[model samples]
Target: MRPTDIDDPQYFHRVVDCQWACPAHTPVPEYIRLIAQGRYDDAYMLNWESNVFPGILGRTCDRPCEPACRRSRLPEDKPVAICRLKRVAADYRGDISGRLPQIPAAKNGSKRIALLGAGPASLTVARDLAPLGYHCTLIEKDPRGGGLMRTNIPSFRLPEKVLNEEVDYILRMGLETRFGEEVTSLKAVLDEGFDAVFVGTGAPRGKDLDLPGRREADANIHIG
Candidate 1:
């Protein structure tokens, strides 16, 4: 056990298991290591570069990285609580309002994109693309944005206020959202002067299991 390893078991494991995790291949250990050292601003920026919803993920990830934690071999029968630790770091950092990580401002006059939907992918694309001055218009038919986030998902599992705050911040960064306007077809958007359009309409249906003689089971069984 090295000097750094003596501090916290969770922190120690996060440093070692970070590299193989992130899909965007971000410097995971570097940011978490920074958090361990109390260098919060740098950690926030480092985490946000690849994953803008750092605060959200910190609180609500399925935590695949935890299973990879080196401390799982310990007697506790659980790995380092990386997700909760991330939430602790983000919570202490206060509001990240208007202080987004620095990126290139020049547009280079590239392609114009019309993104239809305000889900996670749409939000991520908007966050990255809009800063570059790309003309992005996120259209949704619902009264509010956030796709499944605003609806379907229960408030207890995922707090609506937190979701709204993060979504609002992302939207403030120049992602134009038009409500109650459903694009029935892709051709409509392209015809309206958009060079390209990205659709992110997620799954809007659910399936039911058809077990034998289960149809009337609910009606017959009314427990007191």
Candidate 2:
């Protein structure tokens, strides 16, 4: 998307329409304006504050902002490539190894919690829990964390380096992670010193389709 894609259109028009499109309600036109001024670092930071996964979003987001582009219906039938532009901005300056926000010191001593999975939900829960003064220990069976993100998602979609880097940033927030040990049973984890045990182990078992009512001969076919 060109600078004109946002700035040339009246500022009010760009802001009002684009804001409505973003699910996270990120300041779309503001970041685009910053990019137009070559303040790429600020633009990237702004996007990251609202959505931590800027680079991931850049690569995989289903962009709704493009259709909202006022440039549409003009001489060119094409709308501004908002997704590509966001990716460009992020690609240039989304590095946060040394610049990530520091976790605050713990207030009243809180009990420790053990997290049984290191997937997104578990990781996000820990991230939200850590700053609140709850010490969290994340356990994963794989060599590295990121359950489905590391295993199921193809490398072409999410590069290992990018995923690792982002996960590292979150880990730097003072979470303790142990890899290669599966939580075979809840009995041991709770028996240990853990104050609370959270089992985020995901989708271990698929629903059975061989039941009597679910049989193909009995009724309509259902794919689960």
Candidate 3:
């Protein structure tokens, strides 16, 4: 057999199955090592770099990485508690205000972008574009951000404080926000004269089963 090409990106992915499986491709082992070393802030920051909402994801993410963990392949062994570990870092880390990206006081060029729905998708776009000097205006129908996250998820699963902290991090980047304003028409939004518009309004309705008792028990039975 020829020599292994360690420099190849695929090689790293193949070696680190958990990281490869993550949607954000977060460096799992590196963060885990940081956690082990008691560098909670470093680990949290690393996770934030890849996954914007580490605290929220730690609590609510389905954890696709767990199934792909190398430890799971071993007999009588369980996968690392990667998701919980993420929460540990989030909970234990000190203030990170000084570490966040510094948004430029002056806008970059003359482009202005409008983001519809203050959900995770729009928040992510605002986070990315704001630092680069693009003026981002986030419009949401709800009184606050985190569209479905705030509306659907319960307080027990995802505490409001944790959600607020993460959302504030992005908002502090100087992105203009218009809450309690719903966009009824795309044409109307397009006429606002923004250079670009991104719609991230999430699915508001759930698919229901057409069972005999589905409608009868609809009051108690809820679709996820």
Candidate 4:
């Protein structure tokens, strides 16, 4: 047998099942240990490094890590409350405004990026690029950012304040915003001479079922 290449990063990730299962591959144990030690700020920052919106994700994420937790293998043992623990860190953490990335006064290059829709994906892109000194413009039909998050998600499930706080963090990074305007033509946008354009407009419609009695039950049957 090949003596198990421990040096490969995937090997370590596999050894930690929960981390491996996480899409972000966040150092799960490290943050958990920080939480255990009552280092809420450190724990929150650790989570933020991998997942941009720790507080929002902690509340809404369909935690894949829990199912893959090693403790679940034990008899009568439940998986750790990783999701709730993340929320706890967010709830208890101190002010982190100074910890966020600092954007340069002048743009790094002549590259101007046009991001359509102020959804999570576009916001994340703006967050990453803005700090690196790329000129990012966010155009949204809505009066504000958050896209479907504000339009679709119930306020109870995801409090408006919590969503606003995280989204504001990215917006404050000196990115340009053109709200309440929807783009009708891609060619028109291209004509404006943007170095690149990113489209992140989320799906607003639900797929309909083509089964029998589809027309009869249309009023009562909701696709989503």
Best by lDDT: 3
**Cand. 4 Cα-lDDT:** 0.90
lDDT: the better of candidates 1 and 3: 3
Question: What stretches of model 1 exceed 4 Å from their correct place?
Answer: 1-16, 24-26, 74-77, 101-111, 203-205, 210-224
Q: Which digits, one per residue and each the tens of the lDDT, describe model 2 over residues 1-224? A: 54545333355454567656777667787898999998777888777766666766777778987788778868868877777777778778745555566566873276888999888668777766776777889999988877787887788988887788666666777888898898887888888888888888876554556776576564555444
Candidate number that wins on lDDT, 2 or 4? 4
What is the model-wide C-alpha lDDT for candidate 2? Answer: 0.75
lDDT measured at residue 180 in model 2 versus the true structure, 0 to 100 = 89
lDDT of each: 0.71, 0.75, 0.92, 0.90
Work out the TM-score per prediction.
Answer: 0.76, 0.69, 0.90, 0.89
lDDT of 2 at 80: 73
| Cα TM-score of candidate 4 | 0.89
Q: For candidate 1, lDDT tens digit of each residue in 70-170?
A: 67878878876777766666666756665873334654375667878888778888888777777678898887767877776678766777678767767
Candidate 1's displacement at residue 23, Å, is: 3.7
Tens digits of lDDT, candidate 4, 68-176: 9989999999999999999999889999999999999889776899999999999999988999999999999999999877887888988999899889999999999
- Name every residue pair that clashes in candidate 3: none
**What is the lDDT ranking, best to worst?**
3, 4, 2, 1
Pick out the ten consecutive residues of candidate 4 with the lowest summed lDDT: 5-14
CA RMSD of all predictions? 7.3, 7.4, 3.3, 3.5
